[model samples]
Target: MEEESGLSDVLPRDLASLFSDTYTEESHYQFCGQQLRITQLYGARLGVAAPVWDAALNLCSFFEEQKLNFKGKKIIELGAGTGIVGILLSLLGGDVTLTDLPHTLPQIEKNVSANILAGCPPNVCALSWGFDQVNFPQDYDFVIGADIVYLKETYDLLLCTLQHLCGPSTTMFLSSKMRAEHGTVDFFQHVLPKHFNVDLQWRNVEDNINIYKVTQFQN
Candidate 1:
């Protein structure tokens, strides 16, 4: 499949074909039975070109259920592929910056627009990830990432990006699915202590589905 740049009514349908069997034109997620809308695909399941596997919705459920108050907070989401979490956070009352590689911006923007239930929330921009590569707004109360640790080499870049934007109160909330023989857990364990108070919120230790809730960011 070629990289797509704009939202076409048929684009989601086309993406559905590529990730067939794993994709659904419509999927619903429940945030305390409030019934949030989501599309699920093995990759971009929502017919939306977003790269989120159901993990993004799971993250949203966690925050919503926990009653996270992002009110008047500066927030950022790294690897915001579909922009779902970032958009939802904005709706939950935070100022949000949604960033990903430039190419994925269109899908994210489309998803953000499409999934907004009542009216649109403000979203800042789509950017590439690099330390100080972009200007920081300062005083980040929280940062988030979902299923972003897909490569070992990207580890350092991810941490550097986190350090670049976060202020003292920042909490990095991450959700990931562990793939066999993948070093994501090792990567998290290695760096969590350097910047956060790490704890396993839930780990399907048998199936490799893991959720980590991190807080108290240092430096």
Candidate 2:
């Protein structure tokens, strides 16, 4: 299927066919020469419909291009709303931990189990931004997140969590849609830079999402 600039621009007929009353859909995709399946739970009040967000799509493609070696590496995705990013990494040989709110774990687990082999399937755990401290092995080589910066209230907590998860060698890949609301970029402008060495990696104009590759700066 050809990529559309954004979901808002879905054609009338296409829109009807794209959605389901069941609020769940199976998406088939190929990444790095491997066939993968993603089961997405949509229309949930608790942010389950994030799989279609442009940021997610952009990050998926961005990783395919970069093809950073994930084999035998420890990777974790914060706010793994649909578990797509981590699932992809796991498919590429990374030991992945997909973390999200408790309510969202089932969907993440389903996607992971369906795609990853049984023995070493990606770990699906509950992680509340700024609230829960999960006891997973630390020093994650890569921390990934998408569209996780929507709320200003969670900015400090998110940063603190990232600081805890990221060591000097760890790299964080974040994709956020730029909101038109005033001060939407305030986190990027004021908070993120104060903590990490941030670099803009990619921007998808259709969805207005900016992808940043960041690493923690030593104090």
Per-model TM-score on C-alpha atoms? 0.74, 0.84
What's the CA RMSD for each of the models? 6.3, 5.5
Once fitted onto the true fold, the runs of candidate 2 whose alpha carbons sit more than 4 angstroms away are 1-22, 48-50, 180-184
lDDT of 2 by residue, 44-132 (tens): 23333335566777888898888778999899898887788888888888989888877778888888888877558888887776667
Q: Pick the candidate with the highest lDDT.
A: 2
**Which ranges in model 1 have alpha carbons more than 4 Å from their true place?**
1-26, 32-49, 117-120, 131-133, 204-207, 216-219
Task: Tell me the whole-model lDDT of each prediction, alpha carbons only.
Answer: 0.63, 0.74
Backbone clashes in model 1, listed as residue pairs: 12-47, 40-45, 41-45
Model 1 residue 144 CA deviation (Å) reads 0.9
